[model samples]
Target chain A: MRPLDWVVLSGTLAFIVLYGLYKGRGSNTISKYLLAGKTMPWYAMALSIMATQASAITFISTTGQGYVDGMRFVQFYFGLPIAMIVISSTSVRLFHRANVYTAYEYLEKRFDAKTRTLASIVFLMQRGLSVGVSLYAPAIVLSVILGWPDRLTTLGMGVLITIYTVTGGIKAVTWTDVQQMLIIFAGLFVAFFMIIHLLPPGISFTDAVYLAGAIGKLKAVDAKFDLANRYNLWSGLIGGTFLALSYFGCDQSQVQRYLTGKSIAQSKLSLLFTAMAKIPMQFFILFVGAMVFVFFIFVRPPLLFQPIAMRDLESSQVQPRYAPISAQFDRAFDERREAALGLVDARRAHDGGRRAQWLGQYRQAQARINQARAEGAGVVQQIHGEKEFNDTNYIFLSFVTRYLPAGVVGLVIAVIFAAAMSSSSGEVNSLATVTVIDIYRRHIRQDAPDRHYLWASRVSTAFWAAYAVFFAQYAKNLGSLVEAVNVVGSLFYGTLLGVFVLAFAFRRVTGTAAFIGMLAGESAILATALFTRITFLWFNVIGCAVVIVTGLLISWLRPVRQPVAA
Target chain B: MINSTFMPTHRAEMPDEPPPILGSWSRIYVLVLVYLALLIALSYGFTRYFS
Candidate 1:
């Protein structure tokens, strides 16, 4: 990156951290430290929620997903609004009324300590690993832009976020999240407009959309009912809803965000805002990716978008084998560009015959391009010995650093850092809260003063931050960072959501039954994940179903014991 | 027996105020669901139109 890019990136990051620290002042008490004294407004909580969910991987891999796969991925969020409404109505009110610091705290009030502990451990296990992946995602951006090693960048980001989060607690995290989200929005709008601006002058927006649609990249939804298919309407609605329910309702990171709202109404409003905005926001991001695809169609993109992988391929023994494919890919791109332009002219002139002819040529050229890419992927796999060698996560970043002008490039990079920090801080902070409130204070030192618990919170935050940095060193091996993060969540979220569902709806399920059902549900989820090819989205539904069913059956088998009044 | 010491002060009071804009929490939730439906329909239209 140029000096201006460095200036913008550094300046934006510094301002966010300082602003977070400034807003986070006076977090001395445990409640203020952990819950921001329940004073957060709807807007702050809403942005924090959005920022936490939209990690750097969302920007990096999603746009690349748009380019390579199409916009069907937006359907993955179809259940978010529904999940938001459900959670706002049920979990938000329950947690707020109960005056709990963490979601698991309420599980104990309804069920038993064992159930709450089990759920909390599951959260730590899933979110703990995912936070590392979140930290590792933006390191790819820094690695590509400044040629910094991934390890150093990950460590740097982890430390910076840890410092602020440890000092200011959730207050710093939430307030900075609001700022980071604004930067992300600015970056997204700038990048989208820039892509349009960079497109050849003759290619109007509608013409570009036509080309993208002709090549099957503008498909924002698929109404097909296929369980095996990952991103269709059915999976998105059912699986996505279950996932979002688990994420927004049960996950401490999100629950904690809304829990900081000034009142129950504020919390509900914050979540409802997210419910209304999330779908359109995701659609816009994916559309930006689609536009990036259109942009690359006019300007030749690299055969493999990952620069490091491309360099490694050039030096590997497979270079000779890849050479012909690279040449073919170039030839196909040239032909496709010509056909795309010709199709636009034909459509303008109202010549149906010529339009059809160029459309066929464009499609054939696209097929040839795909074949070349497939060959290149094979070469990459052969060289790396990794079968799932996908460079989708690197595609948009490659475009940004190589194509965009200097200051904007920095702003985009800042957007990435902002995302990484916002997400990682929330995760680490929530992890710390769960550890201290659920485990440390509850199990270890119940009678400790608020000052003691506050100290433990900071220490726990630091420990989790260090652990995330250590785990992030290994996140490089995980393919498609976005999918990797979600798959990891799916593996655990289903069981967590099931436990919450049982707690909320199944009043007769005893604590023992719920606890055992959680174990059974987790086992079933694991079995499905190992033995089946079911899409990850269904894991949430399957896990929740198994837990509820298993809990109910176990409860029915046992004689109902009258509740011993506490 | 399950421990009670870990539990916070349980004051499961009703929310003090109604929803600010929609006048009721249930109405706000319905509006969100309706918004989701409209979004999906529009997305489907976008898909079909583009295709």
Candidate 2:
């Protein structure tokens, strides 16, 4: 990283931390610490929600996904608006009227304590496992790009976020999220326009779009319906709806964001705004990736985007295997670059026949390029002894550091750090909130003073931060960090969603039925994940369905009993 | 369960008011869903045009 980049990165992070600390000053009570005292405006909460969900992994890995896999990943968000509409109507009012700190806390108000406990444990487990990867995913890429140690990067980010989040609490987390999100928006705009500007001479923006489309990188929607197909419209609408319901409706990280809102209307507005905004934001990011793919069509990219993997590939032990793949990759790059130029020239010449001829050659060369890259990844995987691996996470970063100028490079890196802190801060804060509100106060010490729980929340915040950093140190290749994080959530989120569904939708389902329903839902998800070829997105659908059906069946069989008032 | 001090005493009565726009919350929700359908349509257009 250059001196200008360092200045931008450090200066931006310092300002955000200080600003968060300033905004978070008055969080002395349990409510204030966890929910921001219900003082947050809809705009602030909306941005915080976006920032928290748009983790560093989302920012970095998603662009790389666009470059490698086309824009199909965007279909995954088609269900978000539907989910938001569902949430705005149901969960928003229910959660607001209940005046709960965490979403799981509402479970106790509706069902028995065991059901609430089960939901809380599931959230803690899912968020805990995924939170560390949120930090680690970007750190690994930044380490490769900037030559910094991944461990030090994770530790430094963890410490910087902890200072504000632990001190200022959710207030600190939310306001800084607002700031970070604005800056992230600015960074994305800069990166998008700058990448387009860096495209080859004589290639106008329209021509660049044509090139990306010609290679199928611009295929954003697949309308076909297949259960195993992960990103088609059907799964996105159906399975994506379930996953979004689970994440926003049930998870504490998201629930805590809205729980801080000024009122039900404000919180509802926040979610609806997010639903509207998230898709365009994601499509733009993927478009930026598609543009990066176009950028590399003219400018040569390394055979392996990750530097460490590249070095290991060329080491003495692996060089013999790596040489053939390297030669193949180099040849493919030359052919692909030539065919791209030919296609562009044909477009400028307005010759449809020549365009088609060039397009065919362009696709053939592209296939060869993809094949060479796959072989290169195999060599690296064999060298590292990892089960499955790719450098898809490194594509965007490698493009930025190599091509973008100094100040913007720093800004992009700052955007990354800001995203990491924003996302991890929310996670750590919610993890602590659940630890204190759902588990500690409810089960362990029901009569504790607000002052006592306040201290426990602080202590718990520090503990989760420590745990995230420690886990990040060990987090390695999980393919694309964005998909890995979501997959991990799906494992547990389905059952969490099921419990909430029982609370809100099925009025007569008993607490025992709900509790047992959770077990069935989770077991079904686990079995589906282990024994079937179904994609991760369907896990939410399967689990929620199983939970609801089981709960209904059990409720019918059991004798009627007076339920405890929540 | 009898400890009142365990809860926050500063706030009470979470009131749900009508949305500032569209005259009501349900209207606002319909607008959002309509917006979503349009977005998917546009996305499909982008896909079809590009491919």
Candidate 3:
């Protein structure tokens, strides 16, 4: 990046941290630290909710995902609005009325102390690892672009977020997140328009869409209800709804966002705002990725987009053997581009026969290009033996560095950093909230003054921040950082959502029955995950069913003469 | 089974009518139903536009 771009990047980030500290410096009470004194209005709450969910991965890998896999990935969020509605109707009011600091705290009051601990443990395990991946998502890109070691980048990003988050707590996180999200949207809008403006002359936007569609990049709708299909209408609706409920309703990172609202009505409205905006925002991001995919059709993209992968090959002992394969791939790419351009020109001329001929030829050329790219990937993998070799995450970054103008490049890079900070800050804040509220205050040092716990919140924030950074350094082996996080979430979201459902809807189930049901449900989900090849989204549905059935059955078998209030 | 002339009495006067509990969750069903409708509509609209 140029010096001017670095100035913008540094200036934007610095302003956020300094602003958060300035606004939230005098937080002396635990309520101020954890719930931001319940002073936030609807707008701040809505944006914070979005920012926490829209990680650096959303900005970086999502575009890349669109570029590689097309817009089909947008189907994953098809269940979000419904999930929001469910949570706002049920859990939102419940949490607001209970006046709890963490979501798990409600579990204890509604169930038992042990159940709360179990839920908290599940949250910590999932969020901790996810926070690590969230940190790594942007670190990998920045490190590759700036030529910095991954460790330095990870530590730098971690420390920067921890500064404001530890000082201001939830207030800092929500306020900074609001600012960060604004910048993120601004940066993405600029990049989106610039992409359209940069498209080659004589190729209309409609033509570009047609070409992308022809290549199967626009397969966003699939009617089939195949269990293995990850993102179809069926899985997205049913499985996706459960996933959303678990994520937004139960996850402290999200629960903490709306929990800051002053009134139940305000919190419900805030979530409703998210419900309305979430899909459009995601659509925009995925569309950016799709446009990036179209952009690559005309440009001569690299055989291997990942800098690390390319570096390994360039410096390896097998460089000589790999040189010919790389050349072959480049030749195929050029041929494909020529063919695509010919098809575009034919369409412009309004000649049906010519257009059909050129389109057919372009299809064949595209096939050859895919074959060549695959062959090159295999060679690269063979050379870097025993290592994961997917480059989908790096593709969009490569495009920005290689193709985008200098100042825009830096702005987009800053956008990525903003996304990383937005997500990681939320993670650290929630982790600290749960740690201080559920574990520290509940179990240890229960009678300590609020000041002691207030200090403990800051301490825990720093600890989790450091832990996330450490985890980021070692997560390179995990293939597809996006999928890895979701897979982990899938493993636990269902069971957690089930437990919550049992708490609210099934009044007959005893606490013991619900607790045992959750354990059994998680075990069943994990077993299915291992033994079957069903998509991760379905896991949510299965797990929820397990909890409801088992809890109800156990209740029926051991009918309490008089039911416990909890 | 009651005749048309058998009118229901007010809760304060009638012995059969139960008193309203302070936090009886009488509104929860309506709230959940409304929310469920919104979720379905929103999700459907998203898929239609983006897909």
RMSD of each: 2.5, 3.5, 6.8
Taking all chains together, the TM-score of candidate 3 against the true structure is 0.90
Q: How well is candidate 1 docked (DockQ)?
A: 0.41
TM-score each candidate: 0.96, 0.95, 0.90
- The DockQ-based CAPRI class assigned to model 2 is acceptable
DockQ scores for all predicted structures: 0.41, 0.32, 0.05
Model 2 RMSD in Å is: 3.5
Candidate that would win on TM-score: 1
At residue B8, what lDDT does model 1 achieve? 34
Residue A223 alpha-carbon offset, candidate 3, angstroms: 1.9
Q: List the residue pairs that clash in candidate 2.
A: A109-A566
lDDT of 1 by residue, A396-436 (tens): 78888888999999999999889998999999999999999
Q: For each model in turn, which proportion of the native inter-chain contacts is also found?
A: 0.49, 0.50, 0.02
Name the better of 2 and 3 by lDDT.
2
lDDT of 3 by residue, A33-59 (tens): 999888888889999999999888767
User: What residue pairs are clashing in model 3?
Assistant: none
For candidate 2, write residues A1-566 as lDDT tens digits. Answer: 78998899889989998999899999998889999999999999999999999988788878999998889999999999999999988888888877788887777777778888989898898899888988898888888888899999999999998999899999999999999999999999999999888877788999899989888998989999998898999999999899999989998999999989988899999999999999999999999999998999888799889889889988999888988998988898899989988998998899999999989998898889889888888888887777777677788888888888998999999999999999999999999999999899988999978999999999999999999999998877445555666777889989999888888877777788989999999999999999999999999999999999999999889846553557
Shift in Å, residue A29, candidate 1: 0.6
Model 1 chain A: lowest-lDDT 10 consecutive positions: A476-485
Please state the error at residue A385 of candidate 3 in Å: 0.9
Q: Could you tell me how far off, in angstroms, the CA of residue A184 lies in candidate 3 after the best superposition?
A: 0.9
